[model samples]
Target: MNKVIIDEDIVLKGEHLSIVFGGLKAVEDFNIEIKKGELVGLIGPNGAGKTTAFNLLTGVYKPTSGNIYLNGTNVSRLSPHKRVAKGIARTFQNIRLFKKLSVLDNVKIACNSNMKYSPLTAIFRLPNFWKEEKELDRKAKDILAVFGLNEVEEEYAVNLPYGKQRKLEIARAIATDPKIILLDEPAAGMNPTETEELMETIKIVKEKYDVSILLIEHDMKLVMGICERIIVLNYGKIIASGIPEEIQSNKTVITAYLGEEVE
Candidate 1:
């Protein structure tokens, strides 16, 4: 993987983002600024509101107070689909996919949103529909190849082993042509070997797609190994932020998650 040059251009910004549910504050005073091609990680123990932060940025939940800016435009109130149109795409922690669908079909569905054909054209199997379908098929195959998933294009998503399934989810996310992709717990439930493979895949994804990535992951080795910058969250708040080496020895981050600081 080529080394990522963290640029000064900010693509996504969340300023003072906070959300409250009844008496609980799921996230508070959250601020993150991501450069156009940087890969950042969000790490914390479970229920620390790491996913909640993702939700706020992706418009799954309106910030009770604060603002979200994408490419210098305020997108705090835009709908999720609108955000997707603005180059924000994400994969779920739970490995959400069309279980019965072939891997190629899964990616083509993402491409369909960009197709110019009308509903009537699609229903009638018109020329435009066929034209767009062919292009989408090629695009899907290309991205699948980028993720090393092309060989399994005809396989059902549910039939993929756990790690390949994660790769497929990311491929689907990138197929939407996002400028910034949010990945939620991409290393969840993987063994050591699989996690290592995933870390490399993420670097490849960044290079192939040329997109910024903000991920939520608990695997310390994966997070510390791959992320250019790491943000530590605890109880819905960011407690630490820095490069991996700094994070490795930070007392607060260690206390929050690792029980003790590393030597």
Candidate 2:
């Protein structure tokens, strides 16, 4: 039970967060803070409650206890859609895309969450609706170009390569224009080269958009290379949290990963 010093410039804060399903406790006494514009990593072995914690933060599931705050505002009561509108967006561990929709359209759909036009106006093709539609399309195209997916703008999402699909998912999330983005295993199924490219893309995205990132990655190399800070979870609770060098040498973290007490 080593105590790790947490910084105070937190943009997203979880206070005593916990979640339970029936009689099984998934996450307990979870507390973490993500600083503004910082790239942080959340890592642990499978079933460590990493994804469950993610669900609580993103409003996919209500917390059984504790609270979540974004920019000092209590957002625990907000719905998923409202959370997105309030500058929080997330990508799934499994890629979720509309297979029949083109890459451009998939990204466009993310932007539609905040669309200004009413359904009646859009259905009737009113002048204001048409104007807003055009603007949305233009913005979506711009986002695709930023991700180097403009070439495949017309290609169906299901037709893209696996790595490209991953990138497209990120592009779609970014299209929502959120201040904080949660990415679950962004480099899960990529080769070294593709992972390297994704690392660069992530860095560029954070710098250019000024967005804070919370990443869950099992790839040690990728996590150590990209994340400024790392939090390690085990058995539904945080065991260690620190910078890369500190985490590498931490006794509790080493034991958690290696399955034996560190001397």
Candidate 3:
């Protein structure tokens, strides 16, 4: 009956998080704490509730029971938009981009959420609105440049290679200026070469943007390489929580992946 004890320096903390869908429990007694500036991984087999947890955190689905806190503020009741304003943003496992929009415009659209200019002023083309728009354009461009996407800024997102499209998703998430980013399978469909490049890009994003990340990835190699800590889930609950090496050697994690060793 021993439970995993979390460290106290928690930036994003969830307590007894559970989600029940019509008498079926999708997530049960789930808990996690993401410390400031820490890059952590959430790993699990299919149906382990990794994506479900992300949905609860981002307000896509409300938890049936639990508390979600961000930077010491209770955020369980906040709407998705309000959560973004409170510094939480996430990218989906599937690529979701404005396919018709240029790369720069996609990034710019994310920035619009934080823009201070009033719509009335923008519609009227006021001097103040113009100034704010200029500032936002500059900031969006700077963020795109960090991801090495400035070169393709004017190109349509649908035309970019698969890897660049993934990068653009990350860039858009960052453009929201979130303190915590949830990346769900950032390297899902990439070749090894693309994954390697993406690994580097993820590291760069962490350092340059000064944001903590919670990654949900199935690629063991990528997860082991970049994550400072790893949380393994099975059957909608955490089975093992430790550093990469510890996770690699954990008996519970091994059994979860390989099934219990037959007697």
Top-lDDT candidate index: 3
Q: For candidate 1, what is the TM-score?
A: 0.93
Give the least accurate 10-residue stretch of model 1, judged by summed lDDT.
1-10
What's the TM for model 3?
0.94
TM-score on alpha carbons, each prediction: 0.93, 0.93, 0.94
lDDT of all predictions? 0.89, 0.89, 0.90
lDDT-wise, the better of 1 and 3 is: 3
- Per-residue CA lDDT of model 3 for 42-61, tens digit only, reads 99887788999999988899
Worst 10 residues of 3 by lDDT: 1-10
**Model 3 misplaced regions, further than 4 Å:** 1-9, 260-263
Instruction: Go through the candidates in order and give the C-alpha RMSD of each one to the true structure.
Output: 5.0, 4.7, 4.3
Q: TM-score-based ranking, best first?
A: 3, 2, 1
In model 1, the runs with Cα more than 4 Å from the true position are: 1-8, 258-263
Winner on TM-score between 1 and 3 is 3
